[model samples]
Structures are given as C-alpha cells and as structure tokens.
Target: MKYVIILGDGMADEPIEELGGKTPLEYARTPVMDDLAGRSEVGLACTIPQGMKPGSDTANLAVLGCNPRQYYTGRSPLEALSIGVDMKEGDIAIRTNLVTLSEEEEAYEDKRILDHSSDEISTEDAAVLLEAVRKELEEDAYHFYVGTSYRHLLIWSKGSVTELTPPHDVLGQRAGDHLPAEEKLRAMQKKSYEILSKHPINLERKAKGLNPANSCWFWGAGTRPSLPSFEGKYHKKGAMISAVDLLKGIAVGTGMANIHVEGANGGLHTNYEGKAQAAADALLKDGFDFVYVHVEAPDEMGHQGSVEKKVQAIEYLDERVICPIREALDKAKEPYRLLVLPDHPTPIRVRTHTSDPIPYLLYDSEKELRRIGAYNEREARISGILVEQGYELIRKLFEN
Candidate 1:
C-alpha cells in the first residue's frame, strides 16, 4: 500500500476574534479537507514532547516516528545536512537568518527586530548580502553558506553551542534584549548590522518599501547529527517534498529522497501545485511507497500574525495541495493511505511555535470510516482519539 503525509507546518492556531472566534483551520474554506474528514480517522497528536521547545526540528522528528528526545541534535544541524555541510566533531552549526532591524536607532542594541525573514527576501539578493558579510566576518574559524531565501548557515570551528533566542520569537522587541550571551556571537551580530544596514541592496529595498535584510540573527546551534535509516525501520522507501532546508535536512539524515520542485519557495506565494504534483509522481511513477509533503506558508503567515493571511494559507493548502494529490492517486487507482496534519501550532495570537496537540486526518482509499465532522481542531478534539506519543502515529499509519 502507498502512503502519503501532507504536513501543513504550524497550521494549528487558537481562536482569533478577528476570525469570528474560530481558528484559521475552522474559519478557512477547506471543502476538500471536510470531505476527507467524513471518511477518515480524525484525531489529535502531540507532535512536541513534553518540556521540549516547540520548534519544527523536534516536532517533525516526532511525526516521522523518530523520537526527538533521542534523534534531534538541533534545528540548524538538520538544515546543515540540506546545505551539504560536512560538519566535523567539534564544529558547530548555527542558523543565520537575514533579519530586518529597525534603522531609526543609532545603537545596534536599541534597534527592534522588525522582521525575522526580512520580508521573505529573494535568495539571489540574500546571497549577495551574505557574501558581503562573509568577506568581512568569515575567517578560518567561521564560514558562511547561503541556504534558501533568508535562511543561511554558519559553521563555527570548535565552537560551543551557545544560548541564542530565535528572532521570530521576539518580534518587535529590542535586538539587545535577545542577543546571544556569548560576547563573540553578539559582536558578530552588531558587525552584520553595520555591514548590511547601508548596503546598496538595503537602499534599493527601502526605495521599493521592502523590509531590508539588515542583520544576521544566529540561533539553532548544534554539532553533527546521526539519524537511523528510515527505510530500515519502516521497510518502505520514502521521499520528502518541502521548500525549507530544515525538512530537506531531515530527509537527508533519514536516507529519504529530497524532491526539489522549481519555484517552491517557503512563502505564501510558494509553488503549492508543483509540490503536490511532485509527491504524486514520486509515489506513482518513482516506485516510492511513502511521500511526505510539507507546506510552510501557514506557519509563516502565523508568525506574521495576520489572521486573514493565515486563513488564506489554509485554504490554499486544501484546494491547491491536498486536492490535487488525492485526485491523482484516485485517478491512478492506487490503494493509498493519506495523512494530513501540522507539526505544531504557530498560533496567530502568540506568533511562535506552541507545544499543542495538532489535529490529524488519516484516510484510507479502500476503507470508509465512520463520518467525522469537518477536519479541524474542535472536531478532532471531540473525536477523543488522542495519540499521547506522537512518534507512534507513523507506526499506526504503516501497520494499520
């Protein structure tokens, strides 16, 4: 039997007053999801382990049946794998985000972090900006590599993992309040601002009213990572389709194929239809038994705290991604088990990841289950089927 997982990253949310006291999933137009819920096993799964930080690194590991408490090294290490960074034993990998800082303040510390993703700046432009930083700051000990849009990597030789706050977590807050405790790391950040704030790119972006990627914010530090083979454990070759480096890195570590779709940027205007078609091709034509499709738009909109955009993102996932993949499988007369869920909740209210149990829908093509309400948080909760151990949910999908 073929298997598919459509992961809408950070799609879960709390009730928003602007959304008429309904979560985005509830408020959005998801007719395809609602139809699938009628014959699917709908429930909740706690993707984040207790006391663990509610980052996608931990949550996605749990969803893929790898216990985060055991396999998760850090977020950047996974992204490092995607970037093909051959990390050494004592080397450290840190996520270097091209973030936007308020330019009105003279002191670097006083500037607020205006945008974690610098308005989702193009990778081409970001690469140029990173090159400037690399020329001035990179040395024998520290090296820089550009990843996807706004996301980059920094490999520090013999560096220790330092406590650094994610820029997204403290949006609209003073940069100094959340700077890394390590003096060297903090100094690098200040230097990055000086280099980028007045760069030609920033001036051009300012002219166009775009958020200038004015500084580098480092976080998600870790050493090398080792993950068990996914095919060995599950006995099925799997593939991953995602725009983000973090998810691609997990695929690299687990020995799964990372299917890259052209134009698939991890933003609201990402290539959703391309991702759906890629997953269908991997399963139908490529002989892969399982495919994991991840969409990052909803989570990004949540981080921006836009209720309307978050709802629109969910609608796109339903109509653009989920509907096409399911139609292709059915047309091919394939007996498939499809699972749809989120890794964690980047609640619009909080604008950060939360360790909340997310709603899931498991649909079997050959069997029809008792009808459930719409595929959403409230209905999933009412179903009363809670998977306390999120890592085991994949087992249930494969074995059942």
Candidate 2:
C-alpha cells in the first residue's frame, strides 16, 4: 500500500496557564484528527533522537531514517537545491530567515520584537530582497544567493566548513540566546542583518502600512546536503510540501521533485488552502507513491501563543486539506495509507522547537478505525502506536 504522510511542524506543546495549563493541541478542536485517533491505533513517535536537538531539518532526516549529525547539510542548502540552485564541492549554503525585528514590541528580544516573525514576506518580494542582499555582498568574497521566502544561500569559498553554525532557527536558538557567530562570522551576520533591515522592499512595505519584515536572521548555516534519493533507496517516487528550504532541499537533493505552491505561507499567518491543495494534487498524480505534506502554520501559531489561530489552522487542515484528500482516496479506492504526526513541539512557553515526544497515528484499511480523541500531546500517548523515532514511524506505515 502507498503512504500519505502529513507532518504538522511544531504541533506539540507544553502546558500553558492561559488554557488552564493545557497545550494548544489539547485545547484545539481537531475533531477529524480525533476521530481518526479513535478509529485507529494511536501512539507517540519521536522524529528525532532523545536529548538531541530537534528541528525540521534534522528531524526530517530522522523521519527519512537518516541521522542529522551525519546527514544534515543545512536548511538553506535544502531550499537552494529545491529551487534548482546547483551546489558543487566546497560550497556552503545557508537558509536565512528574512524576519522583522522591532525592539518595542515583546518581552523576548529575539523571540518577539516589533515583528520577529516570518511568512508575511511574499515570494515575489522575497526575490527582490534576495537581489538586494546579493548586491551588497560584492566584496565579502563569499557568494550569496537568495531563494524563496526569507531564505537566502551563502557560499564560503575560503572558510573552513567547521567555522559556522546553521543560521538562526529552532536549532540556532538552542546554541545560545543570540550571539552572532563566534568572531569572523559575527561581523558578517550583523552586516547581513543591517542590509536586509534597510532594504528598499522593507521601506516599501512600511510605506504601505504592512508589517515590514526588515532584517535577515541567518542561522542553520550548513554546507550542501548529500543524501540518497527515494528512487535510489526505496525504489519509490516521493514529494513533499514544506515551506522550509531545508525540507524542500532534502526532497530535491534526494532526487524528488519539489512541489512549489502559489501563495503557500510559512509563519504565524499563512494560507491554509495553498498547502493542502498542493499536497492533494501531488497525490492525485499517478507516479507518486509517497507524499509528505508538512504544515508550518500550525506550529507558528502555537509558538505565537495564538490559541485561536492554531486551532483555526488545525481545523482548516482537517476540513479543507485532510478531509478532501481522504474523500478522494475513498472514492478512487486508492490502496493508500495515511500517517499523521508532528516533528516536535514548539510550545507556547518555549516558542521554539523542543525534544518532547510528539503524537502519531497511522490509518489503513486493515486496522480497526478509532474515533478521534481530544486535541493534545497526552491524548496520543495512550491512543496511537507510540513509535520512538521517524524511521520507526516510516516502518510502521510500510509494514504489511
């Protein structure tokens, strides 16, 4: 049977006093997911190994059964490769977060600022910003190329591979509060940030009264990722719908066609339909046997502590994306299996990806369907098949 995997990035969470200490997953109205949980054997799965760092890139490697420390190149390179950016030997590509940072808005300087968010940046606008970033880097001796969203790529022709960390992300946040790279890279990242902050695009957005996502937050710096393809390893064609360049890069680097969607949003406020419809269409195409649908909006909403938006996105995925696909599969009588899970939790309290165990559920015609349970991490612990890592989850889906 074929597999339909849906990843809700950063969907898990810690208790929040706002919801009387219940995580967003617990408080949200995920009736469809709950129904699936009740009908199927529910369980918890760890996409990443325990006590190790947790982010989509590394965890996704684990899901693909590859070790991040051993296999991860970096997120930007993944995005760079997905968009057809050719990377050669000794080239380093980084995924830059084109985020807005204002000192007047929130408590956390890095987490919440006048803006400190992503996803509002449009694809066209992102291209413009990337060009601006490229123009300013003429004398640095490092090659800079911008990709989709706020993500750009950096190639260090003269530096050692070990001289940098991945750009700022959940993985970067784990290193230290917000120190620019050690010494040599520090000045570079700082200048890069300034150039992005004052770019013409930010000025244009600000003039229009829109949120100006000025400033580039560069983290998750990595060299080119080298991994085996789906056709090479599993003999099946695969595709993934994810906003992060890292994830997209992985798909492309591994020889999978990266599915680009119009109006696909990444951060707190994003387009739900775009993400869902993209996955649906990919599955409907005949040659694909595995489809990985990664949703970032839910995770972003949870990180912002916007319980309402988080719930709305979850429901949107259910009604608009998941439900429609389920219906299509049913009508076509496609011999397929659906696996649902989260990479890790970006709880409201933490506001970043965590190592906490996330929930997972697998549905096929062979198993007895269970009713959906409450929306929360704890609910899945007792309900679904609690596999320990991403590879295990993959095994469960493919098990006859």
Candidate 3:
C-alpha cells in the first residue's frame, strides 16, 4: 500500500481572541480536512519530547519515527546536509539568518530584532548580502553559505556548539539580551550589523518600505549528523517535498529522495499546487512507497503573528495541497494511507514554537473509521486517542 504524509508545519495554535476565541485551525476554512476527519482516526500526538526545545528539528525527527534524543545531533547539521556541507569532526554548523534589526539604537545590543525573516527577502538578494558579509567576515575558520531565502549557513572550524537563542523566539525584544554568550560569536553578530545596516541593499529596501536584511543572527548550532535510512528502518522507499532546507536535509540524511518543485518558496505565497503534484508524481509514477509533503506557510505566518494569514495558509493547504494529492491518488485507483498533522505549534499568541501535542488525522482509503468531529485541537483531544510517544505515530500509519 502507498503512504503519504501531508505536514502543515507549526499549524497548531491556541485560541485567539481576534479569531473569535478559536484557533486558526478551528477558525480557518479547511473543508477538505474537515470532511476527511469524519472517516479518519483523529487524535493528538506529542511531537516534542519532554524537556526538548520545541523547534522543528527535534519535532520533525519525532514525527518521522526517529527519536530526537537518539538521532538529533542539532538543527543546523540537518540543514548543513541539505546545503551539502561536508562537515568534519570538531567543525560546527550554525544557522545564519538575514534578519532585520531596529536602526534607532546606535549600539547594536540596544537594538530590537524587528524581523527574524527580514520580510522573507528573496534568495537572490539575500545571496548578494551574504556575499558582502562573506568578503568582510569570512576567514579560514568561519565560512558562510547561502541557503533558501533568508536562511543561510555558517561553518565554523573547530568551534563549539554554543547555546544561542533563536531570533524568532525573542521577536521585538532587545537584541543584546539574547546575543550568544560566546564572545567570538557575539562579536561576529555585532560586526554583521555594522556591515549590513547601511549597505546599498538596506538603503534600497528602506526606500521600498521593506524590512532590511540588516543583521545575521546565528543559532541552531551542531556538528555533523547521522540518521538511519528510512527505507531500511520502515521498508519503504520514501521521498520528501519541501521548500525549506531543514526538511531537505532530513531527507538527505535519511536516504529519501528530495523532490524539487520550481517556485516552491517557503512562504505564504509559495507554490502549493506544485508541491502536491510532485508528491502525486513520486507516488504514482516514480514507484516510491512513501511521500512526505511539508508546507511551511502556516509556520511562517505564525512567526509573523498574522492571525488572518495563518488561517488563510491553512485553507490553502486544504484546497491546494491536500485536496489535489487525494484527488490524484483516487483517480489513479491507488490504495493509500494518508496522514495529516503538524510538527509543532507556532502559536500566534506566542509567535514561536511551543511544546504542545499537535492534532493528527490518519485516513485509510480502503477503510473508513467512525465519524469524528472536524479536525481541530478540541476535536482531536476529545477523540481520546493520544499518542504519548510521537515517534510511534508513524508506526501506526505503516502498520494496519
């Protein structure tokens, strides 16, 4: 039987007053998901292990049936794999984001982190800005490589995996308070602001009223990673469709095929239909046993704290991604088991990842379960089917 997982990253949320006291999932128009909930096994799964940081790196590993405590080396290492960074022992990989910092403060420390994603700056423009930083700061020990959009990578030779706060976690907060404790890393970040704040790119962005990619925030530090092959462990030749590097890195490490779709940016306006079509092709034409489709729009909107956009993103996932994949499978007369869920909650209230158990829907094409209410946090919780171990949730999809 064919298997499919449609992951809406950070799709879960708490009740928002602006959303009429309903979470985005509850408030949004997700008719497709809501309809499937009637015949699907709907429940909650704790994607984040207890005490682990509620980041996508750890949660996704859990969702894919790999225990984070065992397989997760670090977040950047996974992205490094996607960037094709051949990390050596003792070398450290750090995520370098082209972020926006408040320009009012003369001292970099006093400035606030205005935007973690720098208004989701284009990768072409970001690459140019990163190149400038590379010329000024890159050395034999430290090197910068541009990834998707605002996400980039920094490989530090013989560097420590120092604790650094994610910029998204402290949005609208004093930048100095969250700077890395390591003096050298902190110094580099400070230097990055100096190099980018008054650059031509910043001036142009300012003219256009766009958040300037004015600083480099480093976080998610780690060494090289080693993950067991998905095919070997699950006996399914899997494929991954995602716009972000992190998911692609996981696919790289897990021996899964990374299906690239043109114009599939990790943003609200990304090509959702392209991702859906790619998954359908991988399963129907490529002879792949499993396909994991990840959509990042909901997570991005959640980080921006846009309640309306987050709701719209969920609707897009329902209409443009989930609906198309299901239609393609049914048209092909394929017996498939489809699983839908989020890795974790990037709550609109908190504007960051939360260690909350996310709701999930498991549907089999051949068999229909008893009807449940619409797919939302409340209904999933009411179903009384809680998977305490998130990694085991994947096993349930593969077996029976």
Candidate 4:
C-alpha cells in the first residue's frame, strides 16, 4: 500500500455569516472530497497538541513523526537547508523577508510586504544584494545571505550573543519587542541597519524604483538540527510536495526527495491546479509510496479574509487536483490510498496560521464508507478514523 497526503496549508476556518453561519470548509461545495469521504473511512485528526497554538514548523514536524522541541532548528534555517545552504553550530539563521522600509517612518519588519513582486523573487536581484550584504555588513560574528524574497539566512559566530526574532513571522502584523537573543544579534541587526540604510544597494533599488529591502529583520535563530528520516520509520520511499522552502527543507533533511517543478509558487497568488498536478505526476512517476502535497494559496486567502477566494480554492482542489488524483488512483493497476486534510487553520478572523486541528477524509477500497461527515473540525470528530495526530495516520497508511 502507498500513502498520498494532501495538505492544504492553513486549511481551517471560523464562522462565516455569509455561508449562513457555516465555516468556509462547511460551506464550500467540495463534492469530490465529500464523495471520497463517503466511499472511505472518514476521520477528523488532531495535527498538534491542544491549546499549544503551534506553528507550521511544529505541526509539520509532528506529521512527519518528529518532535518539534527535540528537532526544530528554525524555519529559515530549514529553508536554507532546502536551498542547499549548510549551517554550522553558533550560526544564527534567520528567514529574512524582502521588504520596503520607509525613510520617514520608523521601520519594522511587519511594515514591509512579505512577498514582493507577487511571489517571484528574482535570483539575479537576490544574488546581487546577497553579495553586497556579505561584502559590507560584517560584524565580528555575523554573516548573511538572501533566501527567497523578503527572506534571508543569517549566521552568527559561536560564542557571539545576539538577541532578536527572525523576521519571517512578523509579516503585516505587530511583532512585540522581545529581548534580543544576545548582544551579538542585537548588534548585527543594528549594523545591518547602519550599512543597509541608504546604502548603494537600496539607492540602486530606489533609482530603479524597485522595492528596497533596506534593513535586515532577523528571527528564528538556531544551529543545525538533527532529525531522523521518515523513511526509516515507514521503510518506504517518500517525497514532500510543497512550494515552501521550509517544507522542502524538512524533506531534504529527512532523506526524502524534493521534486521541484516549474510554475510552482508558494505565495497566495500562484496557480493552485498547476502545482497540484505537478506534485501528483511527480509522485506517480517516481513510484513514491508517500507523497506529501501542501497548498499555500487557501491559507493566504483565509489570512486576507477573502472568503470567496478561499471557497474557490477549495473547489479548485476538488475539481482539478483532488478529483483527478482519485481518478488516477482508480486507473492505477495496483491499489492506492489518498489522505486529504490541512496542517492547521489560518482562519479569516486571525489572518495567520492557527493551531486548530483540521478535518480529513481517507480514501481506499478496503475501508468502508460512512454517513458521518462534515468538512469542519467539529464535524470531523464524528467522521471516520479521527486519529489523535497525523503521525499515526501516516503510519497507518504505510502499515498496509
């Protein structure tokens, strides 16, 4: 038996009056998913511990069978690793965002847009700035490199003290003034500002009228993490299908292959169907027993409070992605299984990833269909399986 895990990033909801008091999931006409739920043993599973309000890093770690506290180095460092950036101990790694800083206003990381130029961060532009930052902004124990747009990786020397939060999470929200990691980190942020403030890079960007990512707002600092592979646990080749660098990094770190396809984007504005098909095809051709597909657009739509878009995205998955995969499985000469669910809820109310456990449906010929169903979390509790966590779900899928 093979496992196909389809994770809609930030998939979950709050009460939407527009749907006559139903959450987006409940209101959306997910006929394909519903049909699968009917044919297969359905279940609502917990992705994380209750009341913990874990981030994607923690939740994904859990789903992959790794304890977050034991192994989560940080999201940005994970992204760095996905991008082939090797991190050493004492290296302060940050997930930097390309942002526009205002000269007339006191700049904070949240003020800048998390995504510049939609979702595409030009490699040439990123490389140029990375070189400049590496050349000019050298503190005794600090170094830097640009990751994706509005994202970067920083390394601080061992024994250097720097106290600061990684800038990746502060997107369009208020990040409270937490104490810096250490003096070194604080100094690094300051020096980064000093050099980047009206520096040639920014000036050139300004002259070109491009978004100037002036100062570096660092967060999620940690050394390299040690994690065991899911391959060992399940004894089957698996692949992580995601556009997010962090997820890809986790796949790479855990000895899984990451299939990168063109026209795939992690931002909310990208094409959802294209991504899903690419992932499904990649998994099918590679003979991977498990394929983990993650979609970020719905979460973005939820965060933006675009109920219509969220519903549409859900339907799109059902029509173009979910339904097609089901058909593919039917056509396959061998039996297969598909698990459809979300990692966490990015409610329209909260506009950020939340710890809400998501509803799910497991489709296979062996499992009997059930009448108990609803796409929402509460309703899923009475659905099929309803396991406590995702690790056990994946484990079960691989067991057969």
RMSD of each: 0.7, 3.8, 0.7, 3.8
For model 4, residues 1-400, the per-residue Cα lDDT tens digits are: 6678887777778778888888877788888887777676666667776654456777787777776656776666677788887777666566554444444465442234342222334555666666666787666666676565555677666744334443333444443253255655555554555566566666777677666665555556556777787788678788887777788888988998887756556655555666666656766776787888777667767755679889877777777677777677666654777878887787877567766667777777566566656555556766445677555666655565
Clashing pairs in 1: none
Off by over 4 Å in 3: none
* TM-score of model 4 (CA atoms): 0.83
Report the Cα lDDT for candidate 2.
0.67
> What's model 1's TM-score?
0.99
Q: Find the 10 residues in a row with the least total lDDT in model 4.
A: 109-118
Model 3 lDDT tens row, 1-400: 8999999999999999987899999999999999999999999999899999999999899989999999988899999999899999999999999999999857898999989999999999999999999999998999999899999999999999899899999999999899999888899999998899889988999999999999999999998989999999999999999999999999999999999999999999999999999999999999999999999999999999999999999999999999999999999999999999999999998899999899999999999787958999999999999999999999989996
* lDDT at 68, model 1: 93
Error of 4 at 36 (Å): 1.3
Each prediction's Cα lDDT score? 0.95, 0.67, 0.95, 0.66
lDDT of 2 by residue, 1-400 (tens): 5678887787777777777777777776677777776766667877777656677777877776576667776666676776677777767665556666553433333543333354357778977876776687545546667665656666665454543433324432422356454564556555555677667877888888777766555566666777877777777688878776667877877777778776666764555667666666777755687888877777777656677777676667676667777777767777778888777787766566778777877788556565646545787776645676566567777777
lDDT of 4 at 22: 82
| TM-score of predicted structure 2 | 0.86
Q: Cα deviation of 194 in candidate 1 (Å)?
A: 0.5
For residue 156, give model 2's deviation from the true position in Å. 1.4
The runs of at least 3 residues in candidate 4 whose Cα sits more than 4 Å from the true structure, single-residue gaps closed, are 50-53, 100-103, 106-132, 159-184, 187-215, 269-274, 384-386
Query: Looking at candidate 2, what is the lDDT of residue 16?
Result: 76
